[model samples]
Target: MNIKPEGRFQVFANIVMILITLIAIIPLILLTIASLTDNSALIRNGYSFVPEKWSVYAYQYIFSSGNSVPHAYWISLVLTASGTLIGLTITTLLAYALSKKFLPGRGILTFIVFFTMLFSGGLVPTYINYTGVFGLKNTFLALMIPGLLMNAFNVMMMKSYFVTSIPEEIMEAANIDGANEFSVFFRVALPLSKPIIATIGLFIGIGYWNDWMNGYIYLTKRTDLYSIQNLLYRMIQNIQFLVNNSSSLTGADKSLGSIPSVSVRMAMAVVGVLPIVIVYPFIQNNFIKGITLGGVKG
Candidate 1:
């Protein structure tokens, strides 16, 4: 029997997808296994699919710390949700306005928004301004407002989607029916913008969830406000410090020896990414569609 060209291509494509899926999934499997492996075994054998020894000390260390991990998770959740909501609102509003050709000063406004995509104020100036003028330092706003709040790239992406995907005639019809700009956006533009909105929202949510820089720089005294990333980082640093200095410290030897270092790092990786991995499947269809359709088409 001879295979049809389409059948051959389909078989090849399926195999390629299977390989790609394994490539993506294997690392996560290894990470979880390594996290569960005994610390001493990890040091002696390195990472292996079949660990000789198993341990839960890494998780116990992370979780038994008076609800710190869960609290950090909560902070990350709040930050992601709030940042995504506010960011989507601002980005969509700006992009919608910029998409309208008849709007006054449209060219100038578009140029300014585009300019930000290419360049940004230096870090020192940004820090000083946010700290001195905006006064967002050492607060929760420090995490949400500074950098992750919005992106020029996202604005441009949404603008392109609006211009290319949505028809101006439909908007005109809504306006002719006594609908104002806000009503048109609420009733028409937004409903048709699910793909881009979801894509941009996921971007913002991930950024906020993974951010440790804002916390590290701003929350010097507010350790309680540390997100999961920040808290995991601190745990690793503290463990490393104790292990490195265990010889000199009188009482640190027993305490440090009991906790798993190498395994804890792996365990932290699993914990940090677990939420995103769990949620990706739910929005993955929208995410894929947005990626394909969000940019300029035709």
Candidate 2:
């Protein structure tokens, strides 16, 4: 068949897109299959989609961590939700306030915020300040505060979006109609910023959901307060420890076959990440829109 140039190009583009989609989806399929494969099957067949045996033992083992798994999930959910809300609000307010051309000290404040993006007090000083000076250790504040709050880069994205996307005339008209600054910001400005807010919220939410460092550093003495990532890290460590000492374990213990193998680790990963996967599709449109609008424009 003699295809036209445009038809040939369309066919090539479709093939490339399909390939890219498969590349992204294939790993998730493998991850799910590997999680369901029995420990012995994984050991023998190496990570095949069709394994000799299958078991839910890995999931059972993960859940068997007592209340730890559920509690950690709760902590992660709370932190992700609260952190996203608080971070987005603060970022929007700062960005909007700075976007106002007439605001006093706007230039200086923007410069200061931008400066922090380039330089920060090193980890040691930050640790000392949070742990010793602020005494946020072993508290929910440890999980919620520190690195997860109010990113300078996100602030700048929001500020740029405000400056470029929002027309100055809209705010001016609102002001002329007796709208106070607070009313203008809350009613007019925020309603127009859904794209940037959703995008920044997703970034902040993911950060909080996946964060383990804050819990590791500040909640050292409080295992009960560990987030999902922190708790999962400990689980992986415990599994390795058991594997290392497997020889020392009695024969009966081994016969019970309670030790979680490679599949269990994959299962734990799926558990940790499944929620984010489920949530992403809903916001995908907004995420794309936000990124497109947030691009640097000359």
Q: Candidate 1: where is the Cα deviation over 4 Å?
A: none
Candidate 2 Cα misplacement greater than 4 A, ranges: 1-11, 248-256
TM-score of each: 0.95, 0.93
> Where does the lowest 10-residue lDDT sum fall in candidate 2?
252-261
For candidate 2, lDDT tens digit of each residue in 173-251?
9999999999999988888888888898898899899899899888978898888899988888877877777788777
lDDT (C-alpha, whole model) for all candidates: 0.89, 0.86
- The TM-score measured for candidate 1 stands at 0.95
Q: Model 2, residue 106: displacement in angstroms?
A: 2.1
* Root-mean-square deviation per candidate: 1.5, 2.1
